[model samples]
Target: WNKLPLAVQTTESLAGSNLWDVPTSHLHPSTNFSSKLFWEPQCQTQLRHLQDRTRITATIPPRLDGHWVSSRCEVRAGPEFLTRSYIFYPTRLFKAFQHYYCDSNCHVPAYSLIIQGKLRLRQASWITHGATEAEHNLQKVTLVIHNQWAAHRLETRLPSSCLRLGSGVQLVPSKLYELFNAKAKRDCLGALHFSMMELDLLRLEIQYHPLHQPSKELFLGDVHTDQNQRAHYRPTGYQQPLQNTMHHIHPCPVCALMYQSSEQSPPILPPSWSIPLNLNGHWISQRCEARPAVLFLTRLFVFNEEHHTWEGTYHHYSDPMCNHRTFTLVASGHYARMEPSSKVQGATELVFKVIRAKVTMFEQTMLQMLNSSEEGSCGQAGGWEPGAEQDITWTAGCGMLGILLPHKEYELFKMEKDHKNRSLLLIGERPTDGSSPDRPVKRPTSFQTPMVQCSPDTAVPQHYSSRSDVSTGPEVSSAIIHHSVFSIFLIVN
Candidate 1:
């Protein structure tokens, strides 16, 4: 008896320590000590013996109640010291619900249990003792559980480590376990498996398991505290009461009809044109003869190709300065394409009708009139009333011309090479003789002609010829007979 370990003395010393206190009522009759301390080791031994006979009941912690994912895993064959690395891919855990058991008083926390997540083994390798060769390779082993428990284990097989018992199982120090718990917030849970490498060492394997379902289930037990400071448990299955199984809710007919209508309806597409006109720009005409002096007609043409309509404003300057010595005209009308004339092959012409035309004074001109006391002097000069219709002829090829009011024409000889520039030269002109409207007087051939290079202060020299013999005949009129004789040049800044 003396050689035997003093279990009774050890328990008495334990009770005397402040770490744990034993109640007098729980003392053993023979030893006069707490029965809990005396029988604890024996009970544990019996539990281990029972665990060997039957599979241990795995308990889950509330913290490990989510999904996990894994990319790599370590595989060790039996008896072999070598560990091989392989891809674990991913796994899923769904419908994880945890519950904690409580005493009758429900005061002390007891075992925690969880039923969630499916365990699937992708590959497993087993090697023979003293051999590096693998004995067998198992693949696609799925452990299906309608409701399973989670076992908490503290791995301490590593050198200089502490073991922790959680949820009725021993937990070991493992890097894989730490990683699994670290990502709990992201709902990703990891699984770490251990195989015996030696008598005292363990080989750790890690794999990632993601959550399969988004829905979560939570179970809570009602608790009450008594005067003795002990907790009592009231079991409850689910937070919400289940509905009647006989009746099933059906979807609304109106909602189904609306969804069907929305699904079957086609989306609206925008209207488009094949040959959209690029006429929304500014066009300036060459300096030519006008009412009072040689002037340049600068027009800003704004066209809506979608609407097939155009509006523009034109400024006629007697001098290139355009300071107070300019006339302004506003007009709007619809335009259409005309058939190409045989006389000028490949030339595209547009028929423009001035549905509304109003001549207004330029700001500089108005200001000059106010300053010079010549207000009424420019009142009736070259100004037209609103809503007045005018017919003009537009010929476009090597050059563009807008023949306005019979003999008066605005010619734009220099067009910007870039279609985006939207600029053209305006040359104002008038017929020298009575010929067909299409066969009006031609421009001078010489580029240095005074009419072609008219300056602001310099008067055009009359000696410079303004006409060229480019066939002044009635045949040109017949070629363009199908088109309306209207033209306007627009210049956009």
Candidate 2:
């Protein structure tokens, strides 16, 4: 015991003092203490002597009670530097402390020591710091121990020296100091150096539960260091499954009716007149026109297959000179397929309704256009009257004939389906009526050339068209019926 280091002696003395002063009454409440026993000097002296004897006979080793994970390690020899990393799984360290009698004599006290499991090295590699002369000579070495096993026993006197023992030491040339005589010289290696080392462990957390289940356990937190000290356990690489549920699902009543109707009896038409499977989707025009000088036109069609109706909204825009004027003409109606006879063939009729036929225009454009009109017809003062500026609004009714009248029948045609590309082509045309000489000789055409399918919830652009003078009222202007060619892509929900 005296041969041990000074630090070891001091630690043993502290442990002895704690043990001698521990209250037996606190440990066992039923036991009573005598007043004389507490105040007697001889009893105190005996307790101190027993503590000293116990300290001399027992040795306390480093505590290895928790789980540990390897993080990083570095080794150096003079100017040479090497580093290694490890991914350690959660491991438990079990320790056993045993006391052995010094001799066969019954009066002899027992000496205590800690017994631990053997540590086996699994892999090793040598690495160089930079491009130096050692790089060529120090090749990375990997050792494989198949069936053979080797264990090296280490006996450390001081637990505080565990860090130095874990690393290794070697002998080298060094100078020794002499107290009384002159200085002496010797060859030795300095203590081992751990330039960088880290050990981490897992941390556990407790959660509240109203009814605790036998098979369930509270979740533990992730691996982290506290005050440069590691923990005991950590989670593995496997992760728990997440919980999720769909929340936003609104079933459309019209779509449900369409499905039922299709299932009852399929519409009979020519093989070429293939109706789109999913028509309850949005469509946008491919080409936009800037007719009427200031007005820019865009056309959009929204077809509700379940309702058997479609709404076409035409968006009109003016140049920046008119404060970027904008308006809309919405024409909504029901569509029915014509019987596939030789007389009518593949034709569809869009029966226009007067339910909500209206035209919206910008206030600025309406004031300017009305001021230049011929007679006082549309309103009290031929239009918006002077001093009634607040009475002027953006929307006006169709009055008599609707905006999309006299041309309702559209010839429906289909192009070859490109199954490889998952697209279908459709073409529709409103034939020339030869009603007005100002009307364009060419027919009005619209198409979904290669309509690619998309999700139903996608947003489609709005359409706008400027009203022709003929549709406004019986007072006709020589404005030609411009053919609008709308190209739209379809998406089904």
Candidate 3:
């Protein structure tokens, strides 16, 4: 026992310290306390397995007095149980000690798994959807399992105020994609629902309960009676099953082409009716070791404004041994094109915008007059049109209209399902002040006052033409216009 591994020795001594087998002598300060692993290694193995698998199916041993720790005894009889069926009561000291051990084992990965026969959240029950396994980066001294509640139950239903739909606020389509991605990572059910009036909150939570009914067990832990009962982790508020819950799972090109060739398919419309401007692309790259990811691609979709419809696809791959890549489609114009490709990386804009009539007219007039070109080389699409089909379109549907709001409200953003659920949130009515003609308007969060467009009675470029025109009624000139050369020229005059 004295020659055993230091960790094993210490653990055994701690467990056996109260025993009468110790020699009757003044306790030696130099006694070998490190040889502690002599007791059953079952506890160690179970702890290690629970940590690695992200699940708790450990077998509990009998106590030294030949009795069991009530709640833990039943867990040993049958592991496949729920609520009070399986519990892990690691003392706070044990977790604190694990911190140093985890640091020393810098490269090791940590996983926590909780498996049961049936899982229930809200009114829905999932018989086969418990987490199979999870892996995490262990380099950090303390790791917080965010969205831990996902394994236990879904988020609480948000209050009625959160269901702000078609209130002129837009929910960025990209943000909804992200919410789904987080759901997959934590193995929690990610649900979003809205039908003009009903709503659901995006929720993430985690917890552990005993295997057996605690009615027979002695009381333990300092229970807080004054705590909010409503906050005690329960699913509330039901939603109708989504008609097209799998909205974004796309078929491969082969399948898409086969379907297209087999049927008399309609011509595919672009993202919007008007040609897009500000065509640009950007890239981001990151890497992780022994840690959970903070970002990943979750969903992709294409909005056909003409048809007022959306077709999309989804992917959920989150394993520590796997590599991740994300491709984003972003543009500003009448119709924002979400270009389709299997591998969406490193693809440049192959085609330029089509030529507008005004820009074409300007170019043709210059050529007919035989004047040297001043616009250098005009793209196929040239010249800006005020009120012409701007590249992006904002129709007045409930869900479509909410696309402009901040991402936090994605779960609350919903369109009417009875009719075609098109992009309800569309980009319409440029800042009418005529200041910075093509600039986009900024949306405010709950943190600040909302910005509104100038009313019909308010004057535009005329009233805001000079410093004297500044109004004290919480009205500030558009930031983009304030920095524009046109604004400076008008002010100087």
Q: Estimate each model's TM-score.
A: 0.22, 0.27, 0.15
Candidate 1 ranges with C-alpha deviation above 4 Å: 1-277, 281-293, 362-493
Which candidate number would show the highest TM-score if scored against the true structure? 2
Residue 210's lDDT within candidate 3 is 40
Residue-pair clashes, model 2: 11
Ordered from best to worst lDDT, the candidate numbers read: 2, 1, 3
CA lDDT, every model vs. true structure = 0.22, 0.24, 0.17
Q: Estimate, for each residue in 372-473, the C-alpha lDDT of model 2 and write its tens digit.
A: 544422222345432232111123322111122222333332333232433333333222121211132221222222232222322222322222211121
lDDT of 3 at 447: 11
Write down the lDDT that model 3 would get: 0.17
Q: How do the residues 383-473 of candidate 3 rate in per-residue lDDT, one tens digit apiece?
A: 3222121111121111211122111101001111111221121111111122221221121100100111111111101110001111111
TM-score of 3: 0.15
**Where is the poorest 10-residue window by lDDT in model 2?**
127-136
Off by over 4 Å in 3: 1-230, 235-392, 396-493
Quote the positional error of residue 25 for candidate 1 in Å: 99
How far off is residue 221 in model 3, in Å? 22
Candidate achieving the largest lDDT: 2
RMSD of 2: 39.5
Writing each residue's lDDT as its tens digit, candidate 1 over 1-493 gives: 2332222111011123221222221111221111011112322243233223112111111112232211101011110111111111234233221112121111222222122233222111111000011111222111111112212211222111221225445432111122112124321111222211110100111111133212221112111111121112221110111111111112112122222211112111111111222443322222121220122233334444445454444554322112222334554555555443222212234444444343433323232332343222323323323222122222111011222321222121221222222232222122211111232223211011011111111111111111112111112121121111122222111
Instruction: Output the TM-score of candidate 1.
Output: 0.22
